[model samples]
Target: MLADSSSSLAHGHKGRTGLVRILFATRHSLAGLRAAYTGENAFRQEIWAASVMLPLALWLGQGWVEKALLMGAVLLVLIVELLNSAIEATVDRVSMELHELSKRAKDLASAAVFLSLVLCGGVWLAALWHRFVPG
Candidate 1:
């Protein structure tokens, strides 16, 4: 007769252990959100933007749509910058040679990041204007 390990009481204990493992894994996964948006200049800029905007948002009595737009803009820029940095890091890791194509790719990625930041700034300005200087 084959032993039914799947139905064994030990399997129940294993399930509990798996649940515990998943919980810790989830905690770490959530922690990655902070890291995803972290960099020297990137963090500084994000903090500055938030510091300036948070108060304005509160004062404006921002509705959900405005809040979403503002948050979405900031997050989009930060996430794009993070991805750009990652791409550069990977490219550098692969080779340190001065290849034109690699340099061009990196520059393009950097430009994309800058564009996202610009878009975020535009969104911020529009939100602030609408809040404080409504027509």
Candidate 2:
């Protein structure tokens, strides 16, 4: 029943509706996590950092909003890193040659990751200051 454009956008998953689509998506997502954890050293390091920060966020945050903000920031770093890795991988897959566009794409993705880390650090510092420093 989909239009031509909609059908083309399905990416061959037209038959996978409802529960089937959800299950397939979950499986693919888990596979991505596994691949990122195993293959990307930065991702592994971020996972380790998140393991520590998540528990600390619970203790340091006095309320739900603080806790969520702290936790979300940490997660944002991981999300950005994953995206960066994916972009790099795709660029590399296209060609290993030293192309300007490839370099720019990788650089842009790296900047995104850097920005996410800065955001995470700022959020955590603000939380710590709010908790410990007298205003």
Q: Candidates' TM-scores?
A: 0.65, 0.90
Worst 10 residues of 1 by lDDT: 8-17
User: Pairing residues by index, what is the TM-score of model 1?
Assistant: 0.65
lDDT tens per residue, model 1, 29-93: 56654665464476557667767765665555378788777777766876777677778878989
Tell me the tens digit of each residue's lDDT in model 2 across 1-135: 537866765776656778888999999999999999999999999999999999999999989999999999999999999999999999999999999999999999999999999999999999999999998
lDDT: worst 10-residue window of model 2: 1-10
Cα lDDT, model 2, residue 58: 100
- After superposition on all C-alphas, the RMSD of every candidate to the true structure, in Å, is 8.3, 3.5
Name the runs in model 2 displaced over 4 angstroms.
1-12
Judge candidate 1 at residue 51 and give its lDDT: 73
